[model samples]
Target: MNRTPEDRIVELGLVLPDVVSPAGSFQPSVKSGPYVYTSGQLPIVNGKLVMTGKLGQTVTTQQAAELAAICALNALAAVRAEVRELSRVRRIVKVVGFVTSVPDYSDQPAVVNGAGDLLTEIFGRAGTHARSAIGVVALPRNAPVELELIAEIAD
Candidate 1:
């Protein structure tokens, strides 16, 4: 039998990686009213940061896009943990994604679509949300992608 979303998460081997550790001493996530907001999550595996540098430079756009998706997945893990269950996720709300890009790169938004696309695939309609794709010089830990999430949960 196929795994449900929760089981698929486990099958995909996601372990949440200890909530990314509050790089500048801010909480990884905060609950305000019925929403849980997550800080940026980098593509990390086995407690070590993976995929670094500017897109279209040290990293290809395709690679950066994939990293961006993983970052969103991690963010989802954080949100699900906070809301206590995936079932509480009423809507994705918004996703703010940041990409490390070279000065001339104008495909930042396309790269971030990797995250948005995955969210839709996983959560179906609930994953559709307001979004922002930001381009920056660098991200924490020099990661190629960093993503933040805002999710509305059940009462």
Candidate 2:
């Protein structure tokens, strides 16, 4: 708990990539009062999706999970851009993950754990939050996974 979330990210050797530009009219993140909400983030690096295709089709659960982690990092980047620092986050309030999957793929929660686990590692107890994992047939840019986060800012 002594280590800050930013410090934990560096200790974990994970770099938050640059925030990707929103593909549409919406902002990447919006801060209102004590909370910051990030738009859906894809598993993109340097402006390109890491992988495409549905789970149980061309992507495996593990791969999707990794991609979901990348989405989490991207979400953090968006949050940082809005709030100016991860240290300002008091806790992660909510997370919603979407996975493009084959009809029979019923392990959406497992994939979303990729994001949740990383957040837990970086923020410790504060990372725990209410979450929803959804399965869909498609996503923007054909990303295998996408996630959004709601973070409460410290006063």
Name the top TM-score candidate. 2
lDDT by residue for model 1 over 1-155, one digit each (tens)? 73345665565565444455555877767889999999888887667877778987888888888888888878877887687767677888998889888888889888889888877766778889999998899887888889999999888
TM-scores vs. true structure, each candidate: 0.89, 0.97
lDDT of 2 by residue, 1-155 (tens): 56777788989998988899999999999999999999999999898889999999999999998999999999999999988889889999999999999999999999999999999998989999999999999998888999999999987
**How many angstroms is residue 152 displaced in model 2 relative to the true structure, after the best TM-score fit?**
0.2
Looking at candidate 1, the ten consecutive residues that score lowest on lDDT are 14-23
Q: What's the lDDT of the predicted structure labeled candidate 2?
A: 0.94
> Which residue pairs show backbone clashes in model 1?
none
Q: Give the TM-score of candidate 1.
A: 0.89
